[model samples]
Target: MQESWRDEVSLLPEELKEILDITAKHNRWRKYETINLIASENTMSPLATSAYMSDMMHRYAEGKPFKRYYQGTRYVDEIEVRVMKLMGELLRADYVDPRPISGTTANASVFRVLGKCGSKAVIAPVQAGAHVSHTKFGTLGALCIEHIEMPYDPDQMNIDVDHAVKLIEEVKPSFVVLGASVYLFPHPVREIADAAHSVNAKLVYDAAHVLGLITGKRWRNPLDHGADLLTASTHKTFPGPQGGIIATRDGQLYKPISRAVFPYFVSNHHLHRLPALAVTAVEMKHFGEAYADQIVRNARALAEALAAEGFKVLGEHLGYTRSHQVVLDVRKQGGGAKAAQLLEEANIIVNKNLLPYDPPDAIKDPSGLRLGVQEMTRYGMKEDNMKDIARFMRRVLIDGEDPRKIAEEVKAYRREYTKVHYCFDVNTLEDGKLYLLY
Candidate 1:
């Protein structure tokens, strides 16, 4: 295929050639050379990717399955309906809507339903890992929903349950949001759910970062613990395509949120994502438990290794982490910006994040680095490989080695991990050919 692409590009204009060349270079670099620790990112399995590239990409289905505003959507209607069924089974939900295009869109849909102008919604603060969509700076602000932050407990590295409950009762918010972006431990969903319910408010749990673990039974399902709605991204630990899903057992809330997903926020619904998401749902049903277990184990192992390498790993008293993410205080290594840039230079990808104690003004250069093990775990990495990754980071950050040298070592070491695991496909990367860059 590379040879064929080269031949085809030979007859193309310089601009098109340059774009293709840059894309190829990126695929080679990210897919075959770097270690990805970006907590919010993941790659779809080859089977799912193949499904994603179907002819559905060229079509549109503007409304609910079987009731679409467009004709010729019969196949998509069936696929989308089945996808929702699979998701409902995995989520233990009475209703599942796969229409929202992204996690933020799902949140926007629900927030629109429960929150009115001048109404309040209590959420985990930014320091507690609340995604921006839940805050005043994003969706909530745009929709005119008052954003109230639940207090954070730094020692627990989670929401201050008792205080949050009290706040929820006092404020009597329209809803409460749990789950997080930099999540390390499960939120106090049950406790806050009771509080929200007592005040006649809904609880919206954003499982954007932990949906895979929840499905795998490694993490608690918010619905089982009394959450009214759950929103998540398919591409995080879930290992599906880039899309969003909303699930709930609350019949009263489902129809409105479903409508919000359509006429209010999303259209077309990215028809191509449906088949790929369905494929991943099938894969998750077969292998989610083992995959999720390995992801958590790898996260803990990486945290322990990094701590041993002189990094201030967070949540030590809570066993480092119970999810796929590991957080580290990189202030001693020159703050989150320098540390993340250094790691990226060494072919280790990570993102800077604000620690609990960080002031809001610190967004430009927060004190923490957020790392996730889900992507590498999907590539068949285990606890021992995590320790090796730690050593690589230590050499780059602590020992101050030249990043270019580390990059070469990373490339060589990464060559062996080109196959996607926990999916029913006898597929593997040959040379730099079958790459999933996103």
Candidate 2:
């Protein structure tokens, strides 16, 4: 560590000191204590963090690798190409653009590439947990884009394919975005793509939350289903660093997409950090299948356990989740934000999400809490782990109703699960310091 950095981090008011101290403590705790269920968060490998906090984030090499707008990109060129190769192989893409900066930018790049102006597109409503990158800010200042919502069967809360087909026929959009952050079932991508193709609209899948599952074949592959492009965040289920990826099957579309990203949507790009993504891609190639499989198993197990404990987990009503996420309709327990706050008090981390067809007016405190299996799966939890976690929920929300006591129980539970375990020589930290092994 740098000497100046030590002093810089230490130079804070006593109150601020206490806050930063605990925040650092929680980083260690997240490395050490409690279960992590947030679907969108995960523990990146130490090497990946090393790539960021240690070196790469500071390097601001402008423009593309090799052909930079500035100079001294000799090594950065190699790094970017290598990262692109790893990502292509991992995603099975004909071409890969690793410089979209985030999933939103990736989608924005897709939009910019597929249209000139006044182009139509289809997506799930954001209230249904679709990302804003596709349905919100991504289009706010877009290329004269028109946003259309995916049809959903209100009675079933799943995609209303018949209605979607009818709308695709009506709009004949330039692109159709097949994605939803919260909808738990596998979308019939091939079916959706077929519908879009009949109207000559390009198909793009925003597999932001479920890419890891798809990579493992645990979820449907948009590529096989005729998607022209796939975009996702590296952190969510890929469990890598925080960034985005864009992949496409058409060689013809690659340069236009690259052109859209360069000199337009993104400028001067972070050339040096591509190696961090390179390292993550390498790691994913090795453990993705196993990690993905474990995540799905954990989701189903947790869902069944939660349902048996009397929580209204949504998936089981039709088919249990085929992915890592599960939704608890917590309206019966309390409003979602309130339920989430209660869970957080007990050292359980989850987020409030809107249920299908929830009113737009109930924005802040929707009626659902979203959970995922990726982080718990990292701590070596599985089917049996769900039983204990569900019991913990039942105790606080159903029986004892004392969140303080639940916190104690949660801590006790954390101790049982995270005790002295290592993968590739990494374990969660218990004290203020991080250690490779204990």
Candidate 2 stretches greater than 4 Å from native? 1-22, 136-144, 268-273, 416-423, 426-438
lDDT of 2 by residue, 1-438 (tens): 599997987777889989888899987566555667888887666655555553444466556667777666677678788988888887788788888777888888888878657677888777766776676345534566877888877556667888888898988888888777885786768878898889888888888898878776678778877888898877788766677888988988878888888767777555434766776677777777887888888898899999999999885766678788998888888789888888878878888888875886676989888898887786778899888888888777777488877887777778766632113333444554543122
For each of the candidates, give the backbone clash count. Answer: 0, 1
Error of 1 at 336 (Å): 0.5
Q: In order, what is each prediction's RMSD in angstroms?
A: 3.2, 4.5
Clash pairs, candidate 1, are none
Worst 10 residues of 1 by lDDT: 429-438
Off by over 4 Å in 1: 1-8, 427-438
Against the hidden true structure, what lDDT does model 1 obtain? 0.92
Full-model lDDT for every candidate? 0.92, 0.76
Q: Predicted candidate 2: what Cα RMSD to the true structure?
A: 4.5
Superposing every Cα of model 1 onto the true structure, what RMSD results? 3.2
**TM-score of each prediction:** 0.96, 0.89
Best by TM-score: 1
